[model samples]
Target: MLHFFKNLKIFAKILSLSTLLLLFVIIVAAYSLNQTVLLSDKLKSLSKEEIAFLGVANEVSTLQLEKNIYIERALRLILKRKFNESASFFDGSEPVVNKHNLQLIKKTTEGVQVGLAEIDKLVVNLLSKQWSAKIEKNIVNIREDFNKLKGEIVEFDAKVQAFFAASNISSELIEGEILQLERQQDTIDEHIISLMAGVERLTLDIIQESEQLESSAVKRTVIFTLVSVLVGTCLAFMIAKNIRVNLNKGISVAQQLSSGNLAVSFVANQQQDEVGQLLRELELMSQHFRKVLSKVTESSMHISQLASTLSNNTSDTAKDTEAQQSGIEQIASSITEMVSSIQEVSKNAHVAAESTQHADQQATEGHDIVSGVTESISTLVTSVENTSEVIKQLAKETANVESILDVIGSIAEQTNLLALNAAIEAARAGEQGKGFAVVADEVRSLALRTHESTQQIQTLIRNLQQQASNSVTKMDEGCTYAAETVQRATKAEASLKNIASAVNTINSMNMQIASAAEEQSSVAELINQSVEDISHKTQLNAERTHQISKESHDLSSLAETLQSAVKQFKTN
Candidate 1:
């Protein structure tokens, strides 16, 4: 609408400029024709003026010649005394003479008046006779004056003749001038008429051309306006149609998308403009939406399958784990029992080792005691050798005592011979001699008892020496056995210590194995939990994929609707 107003303004300006140009052309043409008509009128007036001037110069020259002839005839007749004839002849020439005279009189009178007036007041004081006398005397005494007057007359005549001749020439010149003026007048009139006719024709032509130009301008404006409006209308309609189609499609797509459907297809309209590009883009978008929908559907199915597998696997794993846990508990209990048995064995071994150590200590002490006893026995054997030497000396001493007793027996036999002598003497003393014989017999009995006691004492000493030797031999044997026993016990104790160290190593290995088994069980439980979490995540993903598929289906349906709407577009 604004563009239309602007075009209208431009058209008004063009129209005003054209009108101004036409007015200027018409004014200039009218001014040139008016000047031509005025020149033609002035030329005709000048031609009439030339003709009148030629007639007046010819008539004045003829009157001056007739006056000269009449004067000469009257003078000759008067000189001959032919008064009557002269009078008669004068009478006969009267009209001609009078006519000339009158003309002369009139001319002379006008010259006299002008001269008299210039003579100041002297002319007014002079009488008619005086004037006449002045005229006659001047005419008689001044022959030179008369001659000069005659010459003047002649000159006047010559001037008259010259005027007449000039008049003839003027006639001819005026005739020629008149003829030229007439011709010019005729030519001017013809040109004026022609110019007028031309002006009329030009005016008509200009009017027609202006009208045609105005008509053409109006027609061009109208045609241009119409074409513009038509093109604009077509453009507006196409734009409005495109907008309506897009809006309708968009609204339909939105509605379908809100409802959630996923099994629709899209179609695009074809064109060769921006609308076509948009439609192609929309079609591509719809295709992509469909592809996305397909992928979403596939993903949902896969997730469902995965969820089912996870649930089944979790159930199986749980059952197997329970059985394995029970078995592990049994194993743990058995291991606990075994540990207790090992501990008991360790305590028993500790006690046995202590006892062995104690026995070994006692055996070491016994070895030292036996070693001292062997040394004491060795000293006892040396003392036995000394005792045997002492026994040999005592036997030598007893043999000597027996020799003294044999000597005493021989002395007693001699004494018995002496007693026989003494008995003879005692016969004299019969009672004293009987008492001495009885005392000698008692002394012999006492000596026999003492000898038996001394023999028994020597046998008791020999028995004491044999018992000391046997005691020393038994102590030496005890010492040898005690040293051997101590050596054996030390070796046995070292062996037992080595066995205890091996048992501790076995216990350490068992603990490490049990710890590793516990760690394996913990890892298995974590794996089971992870499997369950994976199942839950898969289910969530499936739900999301399903939602996306539904959205895509709705979009595809809307795209199809949009394509259908755009199909109605008009290009022609």
Candidate 2:
């Protein structure tokens, strides 16, 4: 008996050790799974925050792009105008250069604004004063040179005219001087063409820089997202693996014990030191399991007898519950059929009410459209009246042009008279006045050409006035048609308003229909609630039936135990 007990102790130790190890493994596995879940949740939260931060960074990038575009445009405008002077932009600005932009974004949009403002002010000042003076001086010199050239052209024209009169002058000599004058005019035109080309090249360079900055900002955003994802993935994998390894060690110990090795124990070899104390506790519990189990076996045998009588009673109870369960199932089926019928009727009523409301909204939109059309037509008529007034102003400007032309003609006549007097004085002065005589002749011929040009311009102005008068007549006819269209549109709008008002009455009727449908829906909901209540009561009954079935199954298990105990006392 001692040997038997000794062997049993060994067996119980093995079995209990197996059980404890298995429970520990299960606990560890559950703990590991919990840790993985927590880490996964944390990673998800971090990813969301990272994504939100990236969005804010992207917003800053977008604002930076807008600022860059503004500055580049302002700079190009300055270069295009050929102004090279700078002006200050520091006047205690709202988005200060050294404050918000510098700190938050790590790039200064306000600094760029400051630079651009300075560039723009410089351009404005240069264009206003220095460039203005340069252009004015150059224009004055060019005009003076052009007037001299014009006088020379007139003298040459006169010489050609004189050559037509002079029988002694050679035609070759007259043609040679005319060719020389044409060559000089060509040289002056070439210089003006070169000046325009230089300004165009400077404008193109500033636009290219702005495009490069925007492309760079987009690249930075893509790179930041990829790096964040990679870091989160690595961190999640490391934490999950550590938890899983600890759980697997406990499972290995449980498997060894279940194979009936009494000496089975976990090797608590972790550097963390928590596994050491847990292994000692498991070892001590295993040493005493056999003694406790022997006492429990004796109690189990006595309990087995009581279970036998319960098994027979449970068998009788099972037959009764089957019939009750069948009846509850039939009641649940009947309630489902009633709910289906109510839903079908409610759906049809809802569809009809929706159609009426949609028709009302359409009528209201039509009224608004007709009203908009009337307002647009009225605007067109007003625009035509304003255009007629502008044409009248054009007519007045044409009249002014005619008056200026008349003044120019009178000035040319005076100039011609003065030149003739100078020429007469130079003729009396003899050899000393030869240059004076040439200048007087040239001025007299230029005056005659100017007088002719003025007369031609006056004739053109009169023709323009006649055309403007014809345009005004056509505009009046267009205005009259537009007024008629507006009147028709207004009448259409009034009709649509009446239609919309009628739709309102129809909509009100639809609302009452909808209210009736809602009442029907409420009744259906009550019926559905009653059906659900029936279903719940039926489910509760089913659950009670299932509980009875479970109790019967337990009773049968106990009855087997009772029968075995009763057999132990047989033939006493």
Candidate 3:
């Protein structure tokens, strides 16, 4: 996609970037709105769950109030020896208990769930022991439990009057004072009332929490909307401006390229986009133009100098002979200087060849040493792997030994039980069982010894297990280190091979240099002999010297004309 965008037109690039930014904004807004809707629905559902929880708490409170009332009536009836009525009222509590099965559990909080579970258990426990034939006796046994919260009979009477003042208990009361009954056993009524209050408080807390969370969600939604609008608008504007700025820069660089300003450095955006590609292409083109311009400038200067020198040297026929004589004398000295340079080149090539051969030798040695190290690491890795396997097997064997120890411990306990049974049987047989009793005692001692031995073995096995765990951890570390070392050594070997290949390439290039140097040296010797021969033949070319001088002037003039045309573009 990045490569494809690099070739896109500037207009298309701007459109794509704008579209992408707008799409991002749309996605962000949609997601924020989606989250808002989900949160709203969740809050609404929580409100419903809290209402349901409140209903359940109310049901529990109503059930507890009825139980306390019925228990009081039943106890009073028992006090009156009205057995039939007491039993009927005792049966009345069962329906209240059956109502507990309808738990309102949907979307309930943890606190609500726990409170309801506690209420269920408390109701079941209280119902089990509330009204029985030994109910008074049982209540008396747990009377000390209420001693901490113990109040006076007057206090109990006042609480009872207030309870009767409530509408539910007022209608359900038998025509007797229930204060005496509640005082007779205060703990049951107090515990049930506490549980009812707890359930009510928990439901209220959940409702309040839901309300606060809903408020927080509303605030977050508003803040997110404002922030998205602010950030999205700024980001879109900045991206559009950046594209336009870079496009202008690309146009300026192209204008510079067209104006023969090759010496001016090309400036463009460094982004991986179409404008950046255009800028980079302009930079490359400018560099090529600079190179051609530089060569043309040098050629122009050379041609101008050659033309002036040719025009001066070919002034007339007499001056041409003097010029030819001077040139022959200079060629002999130049040939001698070229011979000296060729010898120096041959010497340098020999030195380079020797250096490359030595480097190749060192590279080969490094390859061998790295290969050896890799092999050593590989061997160590194998040993570590085998040790790891052994350690794993040891761990398995220890587990099996521990299981066997458990079996032995169970067998020891059974043996001890059997020995005691045998001893009792022997004791019951009286005088004839005396010997058998002694044997039972011996067998009991044997079982005790076996139990003690199994314990010792278990302890030893535990120690062995700990040692095996430590050994396995160390072995794993060693295995990992060895594997890493093998990788490093392999990489070193590969690096050495690469170096060896590079050394061989250098050696081959050195050999070619030595060969080329030898060929140049031979050519230089031949050119030296030709220069000497040309100096001797200078007089024989005296008749043709005037024509040659005229031709040289014409050639120099043409070179200057060509050079001026090429020198128009700036190179620096």
Candidate lDDT (C-alpha), each: 0.46, 0.56, 0.66
TM-score, model 2 to reference: 0.37
lDDT of 2 by residue, 1-572 (tens): 43332223333534644565566556555655565565455445435533443343344335444533443343243233324332222224323532333243223444433433443343333234322334435434433443453344344334433432433223355356446535543443343233222222222222232244345544554554455456545544543454355446656655654554435654644323233334455556545543444444565555555555554554565566556556756765776676576666657666766776677688778878987888888888899899999999999999999999999999999999999999999999999999999999999999999999999999899999999999999999999999889888788878877877877777677667667766766776676677667666656665665565566567657656655553432121
Candidate 3, after superposition: displacement of residue 194 in Å? Answer: 99
Best candidate according to lDDT? 3
Tell me how candidate 3 scores on lDDT.
Answer: 0.66
Weakest lDDT window of 10 consecutive positions for candidate 2: 195-204
Q: Which stretches of candidate 3 lie over 4 Å from their true place?
A: 1-355, 382-386, 425-438, 478-487, 510-572
lDDT, residue 83, candidate 2 = 41
RMSD to the true structure for each prediction, in A, is: 66.0, 39.5, 28.7
**Per-residue lDDT of candidate 1, residues 267-365 (tens digit):** 554443444455556556655666666555555555555555555555555555555555545544555555555555555555555555555555555
Question: What lDDT, from 0 to 1, does candidate 1 have?
Answer: 0.46
Better of 2 and 3 by TM-score: 2
TM-score ranking of the models: 2, 3, 1
